[model samples]
Target: MLRVADIFGRFPQLETEQLILRKMRKDDARDLYEYASDPDVSRHTLWNAHRSLLDSQRFLEAVIEQYKSKEVTNWGIEHKADRKFIGTCGFVYWNPDHRRAEIGYALSKSYWNQGIMSEAAHAVMQFGFKKMLLNRLEARCNVENIGSERVMQKIGMTYEGTIREQLLIRGKFEDVKLYSILRSEVSLEC
Candidate 1:
């Protein structure tokens, strides 16, 4: 079994060929708002389109606070070329007793289809299984989110099943498709 203390004792930073996954800072609010405010970007997510910079700032503040606890871990995705915040990914739910976690991510529409999310998620999967000593890492996306489903598949997660009306997003109950990978299924080469 994984111990929360052992995993949260040190902050983890993940890197890919095109992106850096690190903790979000207050300074990233502007960049985060630029994309988070896009309705297209927020369409499939639970969060509504950000109306102003303050909205993004508030979100960042909450993410910052989560980092102070052992309950969650989030990383701001930074483009290596420009070092701009393009999105965020992290474990939204964790259970050390069960040795499992549920991951989530969002990317700027401008950066979509570039495989950045796949790379970032791949690294995160490694961290979850190896460093965190998690047996299972799972992800879920709205049934209509083909992009997110593709990312989950690219990361070697197997599609589990869709739960009907499993989530109430934007006041509507939405069906969510689940995917998961076990530590035994992933090579601990990270």
Candidate 2:
């Protein structure tokens, strides 16, 4: 029997005033489906928004595999009030040579307007730049994703540039706005 603690050994369960950020698990699929199945939750995300329970299952499988392989740093975001998995927050594209990483996140709509994502971002960004020793952290969002942009800003990441038609999403070219925060700069903010 694999204890959840045995496989993970207690990842950093960061806490803010009202949220929790920690390692994700395969068992979270059922609780996560409540939000992961919503199109709105993944709309601005690079991955095509999940549309069904099966889609969420595939996602959960990938996340579980990622943990087992120690590939990327991904954290699940949960709201303390309800003890629910609202979304994920973490750095994905890690470049040790460049000392940089790419961050991505998604949260359920029910938790929007509550500033939970911003708190999660702050904690994760700190872990990446300071604890993980990353020199640069980047976040990109669809140009129309004002909410995501705001979260980046709240975490003190600087808006850097926009890549026109940088990605193809659902068969259409989409513009992406890039933001960056260097370890030196992030340290000042912290």
Candidate 3:
């Protein structure tokens, strides 16, 4: 069992062939705003599309504080080729006693369907199992989000069924599909 501090003490930086999963910084505001402001990108997410760069900046400020406080926070997804912050991926919550955690992510629409998110998520799952010592890693997405569901499947998570009105997103309750994979079920090649 690991504590949040044990994992977030020094924000971990993960890398893949096409991405650098690192801490979100104040300087990433512009890049974050680029994608976060897109209605299409945020349509299925809990948060509304960012209205301005300030919205992105405010979000990063909170993430920075979370890092300082040794709390849970997201890894900024930086596309290696463009060196731009394209999205975020990380644990939404962790229950060490159960060795379980829920993962979440959001990506720029421009890079959708490119397998970039699947690659990034696979790395995060590997970290959860290998470093975080998680027995089970889970994720949920709005029922209508086929893209997110595909990412979960690509990373080898099994569909676990839908929860009706699981979340109140932007004033309306939305159903979500749950998915999970145990450490024992993971394939490194994923």
Predicted structure with the largest lDDT when compared to the true one: 3
* TM-score, every prediction: 0.95, 0.88, 0.97
Q: How accurate is candidate 2 locally (lDDT)?
A: 0.80
Tens digit of per-residue lDDT, candidate 2, span 1-190: 2233332344567777788887787777877788876778778766765567677788888877777766666789878898888898887677666677888888888888788889888888887765567788999999999999999999899999999999898888999999999877865335
Say which prediction, candidate 1 or candidate 3, comes out ahead on lDDT: 3
Decide which is better by lDDT, 2 or 3. 3
Name the lDDT of candidate 3: 0.93
Q: Comparing candidate 1 with candidate 2, which one achieves the higher TM-score?
A: 1
Which run of 10 residues does model 2 get worst, by summed lDDT? 1-10
lDDT score for candidate 1 against the true structure: 0.89
Sorted on lDDT, highest at the top, how do the candidates line up?
3, 1, 2
* Colliding residue pairs in candidate 1: none
lDDT of 2 at 91: 72
As a whole number from 0 to 100, the lDDT of residue 164 in candidate 1 is 100
Over the stretch 90-120, how does candidate 3's per-residue lDDT look in tens digits?
9899888999999999999999999999999
Cα lDDT tens digits for candidate 1, 105-145: 99999999989999989888888887878999999999999
